[model samples]
Target: MSRQRVVLSLISFLLSFISFSQVTTEVDTTKIRIGEQINYKIKVEADSTVLVVFPEGQTFTPLEAVEALKIDTTKKDSKFKLSRIYKLTQFDSGSYTIPRQKIIIGEKPFYTDSLRVDVGTVEVDTTKQKLYDIKPIIEVEKSSSNWWIWLLVILAALALIGFLLWWFVWREKPLTEEEEIALLPPYDRAKLALKKLDNSQYLIRSEVKEYYSELTMIIRKYLDEKVYERSLESTTDELINRLQLLKEGNQFPFSKETLHNLETILKRADLVKFAKSAPDTALIEMDRATIEKEIESVKAVLPEPTEEEKLLDQQYKEAQERKKKRTKVIITVASLVLLLVATYVGFGLKYGFKYVNDTILRDESKELLEGEWIKSAYGYPPVYIETPEVLKRVQDTLSDESKDKIKQRVFVFDDAEHLDIKIITDEVDGGEQGQEDIQRRVVQSIEKIIEEWETKNVQNIITKDDQFITPNNVEGSKTHGTADFPIKGSDETFEGEYAIFSFATKEGMIAHVTLVWAKEDSYAVDIAERIMNSIEMKSDEQANAEQESQN
Candidate 1:
């Protein structure tokens, strides 16, 4: 009996020792230099079914854990030997104790033994170390890495300076004498033309056609300058007729012999040129002499203008000069404007107009699209949609009798210009109203809205009604059309596209979403599509609850 008792006590002691040894904690070293890491390890032996969780975060108060290595597990028989290492460090040189950390094993909790650590500063041997003076900062020239940039800047500066010098200093110089002579009076110009014709070799080369053509042109040009304004544009017969009229009207004192001589020469020249009637050289010379004498006679008989006529002519010339200058200025400005517009359009087409407008023009549509969007409910049977801006509740202007029969709400997003988005909800007393009756009422409501649009000066309206299904599979009627409407405060008309979506709930409540925008606005279509796709119709109970709350 005594031996058995002693054996039983030994067995109990061994089991208790093994159970206590299941969890053990140790450190690599208790003393360390300041900021030096200490390896602290924890080991646990548990069955595969038991879960062991180590303390996480800053459980070591005085000594911070810099790193916690992943837990390593090894199977020993039916138990897992789990081990975890924590790297700890302390900056201040002092003695510190790591407090006990609570670890969880299955349902029970266990604590690790508190550890003492000494952090000491590193010792320095000052006597044995050789000291040197701090080196002075050397004054080294910094080589420029972007020399080409400076070169380009200098070249641009030189070019600008050259342009300035030419524009301000050199371009305004006076014209030379030859340039002045080129701008001579009309009489001198006619005389010069005659001299040039005489120096030509047409007559010597037996070129009668060329000679006559030049001779007739010179005479007509002289007459154009001094007498009749349309002489150059008129045929020989037309010129004679005009001259006869002028003589009969007493505008010019032309002699009968002079007119007769002039008519004979022009007719003979036309025959030589057009009919191939080659006149003899003697006859041609005689004709030329006669023409010169006739021109001199006409010059002698030319009348001087009265003082009023001279003033009018001078004023006309000055007005022509001013008009010419203004035309040149307009052409130059228009050319610059066209070039800028072309350049802008080229870039816009290449990168997309939206990109150019958003970057350069700061267009409102682009800003609205790219900006923050809001999802909100509108009207009673609230139509849920996302928009670039919040819709505002507008005043209900329906009569009190109409209001009693129908609970109507109107919300609008009006910019007072191009864009006007409105949503209308009408809850009618559907007592004894069938589906067909409800649909008919919805159609009538849409027609009434269209009539209202017409009253607002919407003309040339073209509407098409179609059945559409929402994303949630709710059936609805869509009325879309385009109309020409006058812009506010302007005579200009804008073509506007409007779409009205009428959705009738099972409870006979009609939700009408209306979108109106200028047809030219490219973003309006996208915005309208987005709003239509995002439509979510509320349930009857929710709609009734909202109505009750509103009431």
Candidate 2:
């Protein structure tokens, strides 16, 4: 009787220890068509004070989790009942298993039983299906992007600014009165100078010395141009001696009276100027008249220009006009070049030399940064992101052996030297063993990527590893580093920075986004960062939700 009582007591204790928590797992269906959904549900019952953490991340290998629904809770007496649902799907038609998932309640861990699912392919009756011939390759014109338009606009603006600066600031002003007179022939110029002198107030102001000085200069200028080129530099006696020699030589035939009058006027004017003599108005006027008469006398004796001389003078004038035009052109061109250089320097000092050069030269990286971008999704279990330009799909031919084990899609944008971007999606044939060991696999993948770079002549690699979360809350592993990269088609190399982002799904699919840019190019760096920030994982649930909303 005592042994029976002890057994009952032990059984009660065991029952009490196991009665604190209970869990149930179920799916809406065990069978589904390809690309169809399976609603998975889990329910738990426990005390209100216990902590519970359900499974997260890509734990159900071979069956992808489309979405994790919000938890539902209710009260039953003093206990709480909690229910959680997850939407799952599969694209390939095959038999797959949903692996066991762990649930932690308070300090104890419990696991739910695994389930089996069969995804069947849709049927197609070929007899009723229409068929078409394969299309031939078509040659399409390449698009002329709007960056050229922007370049043209910038050039036009600079040109207009230069013209305005020339017009308002640096152009030649109109000639003054003296300059206009100087453009006339020597004879006409001298006559106009005398008339201007006559208009002076020398006589009215009792400026007798100035009057006599003007009287002598008028005749000296006429003699300088018509007779002797150096007449203006000669003294009074030297001029008279030169005139006498000319008369004797018959180079010029000056009358005796003309010579006498010229000699007397020059001497008197010199005395009035150097000796500071105060000459009377009558004497000043007489000297001026005599000088004018001598000019007329000299002209009468001077021989007329020969036809050859006349032709030579005309040719000389034409040459002078051409030279003036050439000088004007040179000045204008020089000024324009100077203005352009100044503008470029000013912008460089304010912004940066590289920025100005890139804008003018149409650097690929710079254009990508400033140009309009496109936002689209790539690959299945899509990666949604924005990029400066659309990436082109790469068709990779694989061997039959590789094709059976894995399928891959690659998209890329390469600028040869400055920047390169690649997106790769790979799907394995089957769920890998030890799929829960994500960190080790990720590290192996990163090392493999680095090894590939080594084959391409990338060297001196420095790396850092971190966890990255996208704007949509999708998590992935990020490996980034700096290295020396071989320039394409050349023996040269440059310092460059690189980033690789790796993401995985429960169905054994992996996606990698790799970006590389020259370290000296800030624009390329910015482009890479922007592309990284724009990345998001577009789940099947979000796509369906959007479609339903649209409907």
Candidate 3:
């Protein structure tokens, strides 16, 4: 279902709930004016995830909209429930018919009967009364209630300041003993951790795994803190990989032997901790002492200068000299795979979006173009002033960017329901219009629709304002547990997202449109863009003159 209808359906959910596994439909306000606001709510209570649809004709839509549709899904104990509130309204004052709406859930679609309402002409008061004929009630000026309070506060503040000055004249601040000691990190603590290790009575108690794990942790934490500064609490494989990287980068003070000992100790500790194996205390003490010695030796010397390092350096130098010889076979293969995926997704999206954007438009436009139109000299640029006071707002928002590129275009489909489609020309590139709408308009519409959908759908919405993705916070679709992408943009074209949906309107004249959004690398968008760029838009009247000349 469309987002607007989803919201209206939510209203149906809240007000009418039959049972946990069932659906009950109810409407409180049967009558409404053509363009006035009215409220309706529907609710659903279920045990599992359920997809629902609202009555086909009644939904939140712009121009024919009173407010954005609101879908409220609430969970109670083990039951999953959804609620929708629709602020239904119309634009004109006239008797109108609302068709029955279908609600779908769990592969089943339920519906509400068609409802009718009476709309009367707007009532106005023609009788005008004198502006100041009524006797004015005399008002008395009350005493200043805050004057004394302000005076007293100022006097108190002045006295406090004066007293503080006199007190500071003889006052002194002495540093505490604790303040003299600087804060030290785990690395600094690790050097002295051997002392803590000595104090710990591990051998006395039979906490074998705990004792060994703690010792290994101290060693790993020390190496990470003092040497590489990675979190050693991470998995053993991660620690080994990080250590190898450090070895390669010459970013740590450790030989392969020392690293091997550390890894052996850590792996053994993991085994003892998880496998419930008892470690020999005597052997552990001996290994602990050995670990201490290795740590000290590594501290005295930097990364081991093995022949392997020299070989690596020599290979790097040779690679640089003969750079063109290396094709990076691994990366080349990965790039090919990525390109294949992009091509597939791009092509699929292009078809999906084309069907949504073009076929419907063509069908609708055909109905409206009855052959003749008045020459529109009044037509202005096919761009909308999206930002009224854009420069000032952009200047305030971004210090790096001086101004924003805000663009929009409103196309009037001849058939408002099904847009006229299938425009052809002799050459493939030579078409009157593209299969899709303008880029800026697409981006803006998609962003708005997604934001609205989020508000209506996600219970606890956290709107993110920035676009840059950092490694630490990439939150890939898989990582997020949901596949919804945040809206993104760049200056060239709003080339960042997929939130807008192209859909047909009730009027059929407005088809494949509503909140139509496109994502980059989408085949539909790419094809539509290629076709659109080839064709230039002109007023209807200019087309007649061009058509005659061409004929």
Candidate 4:
């Protein structure tokens, strides 16, 4: 009997030691006024040789850890007693759970018991606190408006337009010396050419060949313009034969003496030019005189132009002017067009063909992706996010059964073609449900939303469920995949991608953000991802505090 009693006592001692070594948690109070802190203390009794570590961080969700007080340490009979105190609070009035906290003792982990917290709203005395009317909406300028891009585009367009106008119309174009001479009448031009030849020093320098060449070219050019178009290309013998034929045919009533003088002068000029036979200065002067007299004789023999012939000549000059202007316009336009095409090709090679094509064509998705983004807050328990464009509030009609029980606000930006963004916040007027129940309902709501899409003719729905976290560390559930969406006013459907993010708060408020875009648009995909990453949840208290600080 004595041995049995000793065994029972040893077993009781072992049980008591085991209970003392285990961690225990207790809170000062489970109920508190909104924003009031609760003291949560964790106690552990262990051997002095064991190492201990208390939880540190924002792991106590729903109830935020306001501060971690220094741990209390005491020694009793070679055993150490450790107590860690945490100050926690919740800004909004709701029932929240302080999640299990990890406590490390030596190499092993121990968890503190989860605790429930009830935060009650403080009553507002409207009679004492003066009330004011709601303030009017104030417009705030966007931080990143992409004004530089627009400025660049405007400048580029103006440069191109200015260049085109200068090239085609505004520039002062002067005629060349040859063109000025060509514009003169054949007789006047021939007289001018002879005067110019007399001014030359070819004869003084004994350049007989050059002098003869210029003198003969003057007569040939005059004949080519006035009488025979091919005279300049014809040989000296051919020209003389043509003149004789024209005299015989009565085309020109040339005097025999005049023809004989012209033939003699041309043969002498040819000998001086091609045969290298240098004529004396006196003979060269006499030959020049003969050529001058022959030119006058030919002009006298030519019939005077009739009124109709004069009118035709005037019309021909006008036509030539018009042709020159038209040619200038064509050249300018063609050159500009080729320059633009070359620039486009160069940019394409440097960047990519698709990128260049999209920019040149002003693709909507590309513009939105690269344009300035707006950051704003929406709905109660506001969802803060950044987007390409500001979302406009949409009035949604609720079913008669849910009109009194549910209040919903929706904001959206939908082009019905390339991209669509919808943000929804729903507040239910009822008792707070369990977290599991809320999650289940949220999943059902997601399916219902998808079903609604199906009714709208969305097809081939493929979904993948996963967790999504925002840049601010706000976590939510996400459903994303591909689908075929119906195009407006057409029987066709386009391949598209979509993502849905659902977040629920302790106050029974649910916020959902849905994004849909064309599957082939990489720009749209980037925009969507940026929008998602920028998403953050701000409680009314936090928002109000920030606004006050800003003020």
Q: Write the per-residue lDDT of candidate 2 for residues 1-551, one digit (tens) a residue.
A: 99999999999987765665789998999999998999999889887888877765456656777887777888887677888888998888989888788889998888999899999998888899877899999986555677788899989987997787567555776989888987887677766767877899999998878777777788888899899888999998999999999999999999999989999988888888889877777777777777767777888898999999999999999999789777767877777798779989999999998789988999878888987888887765467778887888897445678765556677888854688888877666554435676456566667877998999889999999889888888888789989998888898899999999988775566778888999988888899899999998745456446644543
lDDT by residue for model 1 over 105-134, one digit each (tens)? 887778889889999998878899877899
**CA displacement after TM-score superposition, residue 347 of candidate 4 (Å):** 3.2
CA lDDT, every model vs. true structure: 0.79, 0.81, 0.47, 0.83
Model 4 clashing residue pairs (backbone): none
Best-to-worst ranking by TM-score = 2, 4, 1, 3
Give the candidate number with the greatest lDDT: 4
- Model 3 agreement with the true structure over 1-551: per-residue lDDT tens digits: 69999999988886555454555545566555556665655666666566554432223222133443445667788777766655666555666554445567777666655556555555655576434577888976543566789899879966775565445432444646444322354445555667677777776777787677667876777676456567566788888878788778777646788778877877888888899877677778877887787767656765445899789978987887466333444444565577657765676587665544444455333223322222221111211111101111111221223112211123321212211111111111111233243333334444654465466342232233323221222211100111233332322322222211121111211111221122332432343333222222233344334443533
RMSD (CA, Å), candidate 2 to true, equals: 8.9
> Across residues 1-551, which tens digit of lDDT does each residue of candidate 4 receive?
99999999999999976765779999999999998999999999887888887775445765667777777899998789999888988777888778788878888888878788889999889989998999999998667656899999979987987787786575777979898998788899999999999999998889999898888888888788777889989987898889889989999888899878877888988887778998788999998888888889889989989999999999998999899789878877887798789889999999999999999899888999888888998875468989998899998657978755666778999864678899888776553578887798789779978998999999999999999876766678899999998877789988999999998876567889999988888988888889888889854355445544643
Evaluation by lDDT, superior candidate among 2 and 4:
4
- Could you tell me every candidate's TM-score relative to the true structure? 0.36, 0.67, 0.23, 0.67
Question: How many clashing residue pairs are found in candidate 4?
Answer: 0
Which residue pairs of candidate 1 clash? none
- Residue-level lDDT for 482 in candidate 4: 97
Candidate 3, residue 289: how far the Cα is off, in Å: 1.4
